[model samples]
Target: MVSSERLADIGYKTFSGTMTLYGGYLCSLRVYRYFHHREQLRIAAENQTEDIIKD
Candidate 1:
């Protein structure tokens, strides 16, 4: 049978590992959103320039 102390230690490690994974997932999502927003801005700027040049 596992000692109470050992059980507590295992629980702590599991919780820490889960949080680490969650943090990484959040960071990846943020990075994806940032790049997506940047690309949209670039496209808009290009379109604006084309409009200005034609006018």
Candidate 2:
């Protein structure tokens, strides 16, 4: 008799690995954008506050 393999086992080796790699890449990009946006806002707010203080 021949043995049959399940799809889940095959998927664990292939699809799951790819998904994890892509997810990590996407997460890093999101974090980078979040920090970049926050920094930009901070700089803008500081500049505005400085101008107001000067006046």
Q: Which pairs of residues clash in candidate 1, taking residues 3 or more apart in a chain or in different chains? A: none
Summed backbone clashes in each candidate are 0, 0
lDDT of 2 by residue, 1-55 (tens): 3334666677668988999999999999999999999999999999999999999
- Where does candidate 2 stray beyond 4 Å? 1-12
Each model's C-alpha lDDT? 1.00, 0.91
lDDT of 1 by residue, 1-55 (tens): 9999999999999999999999999999999999999999999999999999999
Worst 10 residues of 1 by lDDT: 1-10
Which candidate should be chosen as best, given lDDT against the real structure?
A: 1
Off by over 4 Å in 1: none
Give all TM-scores, in the order shown. Answer: 0.92, 0.72
